[model samples]
Target: MTTTTISEVKSINTPSVIQINADIPLDQALEELIRNSKEISITRGKRKGKFETGADKEGLELLPESSKERLQADGIDIQAGYPEAPPREDIPIYLDQAFEIRNYDVPFVDRGKNADPEKKSLFGAATEIINLTKNVGTEIVGLQLEDLTDQQKDELALLIAERVVVFFRDQKLSPSAQHKLGDYYGNVEVHAQVAHVPGLPGTTVIWNDYQVKKGMNLNFATSNLSNWDSTKYLNVGNQGWHTDLVHERQPAGYTHLHLDAIPDVGGDTIWSSGYGAYDKLSDEFKKFLDGKEAVYVSAHQYLDREDPFGGPKRIERVHPLVRTHPATGWKFLYVNRGMTKRIVGLSPVESDLVLNYLFDVYEKNADIQVRFKWTNSKQGYGTSAIWDNRISQHRNVWDHEGDQPRHGTRVTSLAEKPYFDPESKSQREALGKYLHQWD
Candidate 1:
């Protein structure tokens, strides 16, 4: 029998303690105790000190009675208590100390389901398809994402496969609608970590004031870290370019972000093309990396089973460095400067040199990227961007500087595992649009 003390909850005056012997993990034991035990001796105490002004407080304040009623009508569990706004004051920032297991084993679905681009008109209601840049981004001018038909959704999936990212403006898209759109693409990823919208399982909350609300002693916004790599270059700990959730077995496929609130100035987002990045490399270098694999680390840290007392370590997953897009059969550079670590068989120094150069090729190229500023919409509604995460990397520009608020909700769908097909061709090659200058 292992004797342990509950350090997470400590008594202010006199300790109220409970100890039991069980053949299970401490965290599992605690969870079982909370669920089964009738008489818990733990006393709830009012948290001392100031609270950070964040989304939770703002969202709770802005939550309408109709929304709550709708949630209840839809059979949402209301027992999960909401956080109350605390007095605005500074507090020390601490890391997540709770021991929780995060595992995802659901089989991935093919994102390009029943794609029929040849069908009469793909956009259905959309009047125009605006290519934002030469390579990566496109904007569907006339349709609301919420109103897309099954065929249109399939066409949109194919379009995103080709364009990498597409945008829609002046849209009245709700969290539920956005989630449905995500479901059409693949299995919507339910994240264990991060703050989610109330009653919405997979919808992640993207608030500018997250760090402050979470008691982090930081002056800048949480989005600031997205672009930190741009200033630091190849330095360690700088997250420059990144595809979301690359650590998952079946990595993130389609990621939809709808920003309901935008700042007057700053807070733009930029995305770069993986297809173009792959094309930028020489045939010799491409051949060298075609079948190679690299390890990707998770954004959140987890405990190492070998040393439970030791600090948590980031979860890692290995994927092909050059992956073939399932829909387009186009080879794209699958590695990102953020999550991707060293190559599988290469020495640490060799991997570093190769990865740094590959990252530079993707990040330094301007022609293969698109930078979009979220501004006025047609109906003064929110703007949305749906991107194929398998072939693109994006970074949020933190130029807003905390003067204004930017909040959004994001839903991501997990698709098939990263794979490389030897028979796959690069985008330009497949389109018979070879670069004469390079030749």
Candidate 2:
């Protein structure tokens, strides 16, 4: 029993039978921990005097209010979820560390493409979230959107924030439920700049279903010649990476997207960890970036046509390049390829040089990202990936043809405006203790 963060020492969805997913073999799990130990470690006092500005500090000294909320949130005991496990056991792990996989008999289902759990899977992503990637994602086994409970909603949000992003496979989540899920976090944020669902209010319909005209003759010769892929700095109509609605004065906290209609292989989406990106910066660069401001403009495809009723004339706001998470108190990079135009104080040249460099830092690193393939499951099946818009960036790859449907409803929830706190820790440090290897 070494010094551990509260999160590590406390119950992870206690009494819920939390087992390491069965699909993850022992060696693979250990390797993941080893990776966590190396790439994600942010131990206190590790960077003393490394930068001229000072050194990195570790916060999250206190467990959040959600920790208390977690206890009352559900009645699930640790044994219920995973009823099948081997007897209590332990083995000496890497060096001074040892991890024990106690195979206690519990209800742990590693549901993939065809998941039909008698009770849990049919419920929703909240009931059966399985860790899908090493660093960033968790897949909810077989949860139905309509079956989610109030406690599950709260638990799901907390868990998504934990994993950065969580996925639900074959979800039949209705637009109303999607909207309701958004409401669980905060008010349904209506987009001031992008197109919203015509009658449903607060929903955005982003798809490429309309057929191009078959009879092309007049402008077809030159029109078809202009390749969309060749266009630079063009907003390819939301295909590139972006945080949703960053142009708002107070950016949306959570964005939930359900891909009900996706092409078989071409419409996969990927998300990168802002917290990981922040952690990877050199101390000097980190010092230079922290507390710096960036300006994001909601122009291009985001121009607000709904400004007829005295809406915001322009969508623009200045936010810290690195911001602290309100709940976990972790610092995450806030700039994105889509909305962030320039670093506020720097000159145009300096901003472009530095921004391009930082963008490369994120774009080049695959370790901090998770790419997902959608099944576009039928009426009772599909996946809705929900994430903390504040601490992550995502983009959809448009590999499909124009006629293939990739339809989904999105709901954004409003939260506090962006602000950076010096005392914040990175997500690695915040959850490091829970990472068995680090603790």
Q: Which residue segments of model 1 deviate by more than 4 Å?
A: 1-59, 62-114, 216-239, 378-380, 436-439
User: 1-439 in candidate 1: lDDT tens per residue?
Assistant: 2533332334898665566564566654544443343242111101111222223454455433433443455454444432222212211011222122224466665556458755335665779878888778989887878788787888888888989898998777777888888987888877654556666768876654443443333334333443445323321111246788888778899899988777789878889899999999888898899999999876655445445457546668789999998888999998787678899999999998899899888888999999998875443377899899999988777667657767777899988878899999999999898754545
Per-model TM-score versus the true fold: 0.79, 0.62
Q: Pick the candidate with the highest TM-score.
A: 1
Q: For each candidate in the order shown, give its overall lDDT on alpha carbons.
A: 0.69, 0.56
lDDT of 2: 0.56
> How many residue pairs clash per model?
0, 28
**Residue 58 in candidate 1 has what lDDT?**
44
Q: TM-score of the candidate numbered 1?
A: 0.79
